[model samples]
Target: MHRRALLAALLCASVPAVALAVPAPPRRVVSLGGSVTEIVYDLGQGGRLVGDDLSSLYPEAATRLPRVGYYRAAPVEGILALRPDLVLASENAGPPQALERLASLGLTVRRVSDAPSVDSLYRRVEQVAEVLGVPQAGETLAARLRAEIDTARAIPAPRHRALLLVNRSGQFQAAGRDTAANALLGLAGQDNALAAQRGYKPLSAEGLAALAPEMIVITSASLQAVGGMAALRASPGVADTPAARAGRIVPMDDLLALGLGPRLALAIRELKKAAQ
Candidate 1:
């Protein structure tokens, strides 16, 4: 072959090999956690989502998608039926057996951490974006989220000691130091009364009294479960607490309040407003 023709032939051969080596981005994705789904939507990759879990209830439109079930108990059959090219899950999104079984199916299952901190949240966003082949979008979202969080944190620290409670049928469970609720309280500049406790635990009348929270944060679902704010205040143990007595109760959406996702900054802002 002529020198120029040989060079062109070599270039064409290399191009085909390079193209064949690159994997196509996942087009049909499944989100196995609420925060995972929220991050995807925030990154403007919602169009690629084919299915999600029960916990993926943000953005309203996510609810319209087919559900594979709750993250922890997600059934392999339901998920495989969706024919997902990729599945993004939270760190705690499965039983060990289920995840092991899933790995055998020759599909990509990415588990992002659910750590309750601003840094971890940003990392999770980046991880999802990388998987979706949109690293730039992820970077933009992370920067915006950081700025919003900083703005919320600029508010003067509240003097009140607050306890976040999850009330289910009048039974109160307090969110402790390691939880997303505690992280939110810290961002809002309120002292978490249950910070000494490691994780969520049921609070007795004595426990509540010792904590002596001046304000109480409750979820909208929990508040409604016990028949609203009035009913929550009237509940035996809660009524005796300073928060209930002083009418210092704040209610927020369950996912937005507890989930460490795109809504985290908003959650902090809402908590700050309610604290004030």
Candidate 2:
């Protein structure tokens, strides 16, 4: 036989005939954020979720999952014990050291960015779906959410200006442009009085007085901390504000309003009602 033919025959014999190897799917998944957990369940991968952060309270079933501690202060040992093949977390998840430890353990950790707007919220869903190998499911959910948001936006703009306040430990925090509150306000066809600002920041008494929003929207969880609507109105800084003077303060569930998950449609509806 010719040398070239002999070489070809040798190569053919050396390469064994076999089926291509298929990559194994992640069997055990750990979700480290409330929104992440919600998305995983929404994607129909709830059964794969072996562990979840304490904040993953929605969907009822998530509560029964193994608790992995708080989003930011997750216990590395507990996460490792779950033997998760994949870890889905929010961008803000961790004290840095904990995330590093998890990464060092060869865990596949993916961080989904927090969505502060309707568009960004859809993007977040898409991101989660991609990580879970369910891009179609993500697209379907995003489309549905977009339709609801469109319906909400179709409502006529409210006559009143609304201010969204994020109350934390009795301090007043204002959500500005590019925030979830601002997006919800837009969807509800209401103006964000603080739209000119960049992000959530502490508002000084003078700053509150200057804005004088027509309506005040606060997180329900902080109602007690801020002494409720009447007390918020009586605050020295906001006392003279239009929202305070008119007694138009509205309190909403923090998780629903801020989660930026499937409940965004509901959040928009409630905001629209509040605007009216």
Candidate 3:
């Protein structure tokens, strides 16, 4: 009898206690990225969003939200003044110290990954939904995004190769393999001639010549800064490229091209048309 009692005690001790899962239902949330803000709105939880970054300019309604400043340059005082219960931010959002200070203030800060691929983008949506207590909404959004992406992928591949450039000042950078631009280009059935490098980086005139891309894509903001496509093509090093030769340089809005939000599907569609 004593032996049985001992065995029962040991068994009870060995069995781990099941901890209850805590539900995350933040009443007042602040978003620190344009993409994050869009996700919050898509999830039908826009009412919960108390503030947003300056770049959260889509949905037209989002612009009416209280501004929390730019993501990278967020003002700590402005954020603190909002007294947000939870802060949803992109991984790229911040001065590290500002994030630390918010945490120290007993605020729940969730840093979301900046997913660059389609799969990763879905995962990000799911993550945000989970945080917002609306996983079903995320699944719905992911399905729609997947279907749209599939349609884009079904388009005929462009015969001409293209180079995607992100210009800063006079320095020119090209997107390489495994980048967000490369992934989008692949979905659009366009060949990224500069697929050897892993990410965007400065390339020399000789490097551009070696890649011999048939077309060029520049952000409209950069094009304006560089005195438009005509001036870009007139540059000593860029004038000889195949893109210039064929007059296939295309300028698109930077936010439309780089912002990985609900509107990315639209951007992909526009890119497909541009490639043709």
Best TM-score goes to which candidate?
Answer: 1
Model 1 lDDT, full chain set:
0.86
Clashes of each: 0, 0, 0
lDDT of 3 by residue, 31-148 (tens): 9988888888888999998899887877778889899889988888899888899999888899989998999989899987776777777877888898888899999998898888
**TM-score for each predicted model, relative to the true structure:** 0.94, 0.81, 0.80
Over 4 Å off, model 1 = 1-4, 168-170
* Worst window of 10 by summed lDDT in candidate 1: 151-160
Q: List where candidate 3 sits over 4 angstroms from the true fold.
A: 1-24, 64-66, 204-210
The TM-score, computed over Cα atoms with residue i paired to residue i, of candidate 1 is 0.94
Worst 10 residues of 3 by lDDT: 15-24
lDDT of candidate 2 at residue 96, scale 0 to 100: 84
Q: Give Cα-based local distance difference scores for all models.
A: 0.86, 0.82, 0.80
Residue by residue across 4-59, what tens digits does model 2's lDDT show? 99999988876664323544567899998887888888889899999999778788
lDDT of 3: 0.80
* Candidate that would win on lDDT: 1
Q: Over the stretch 1-276, how does candidate 1's per-residue lDDT look in tens digits?
A: 599999998898899888888999999999988999999999999999999998787999899999999998989989899998888889889886787777789878889878988788999999999999999999999999999889878876456899988975567899999898898888888889888889899987777777878999888888888888887788766788788777888988888888878988788877777666
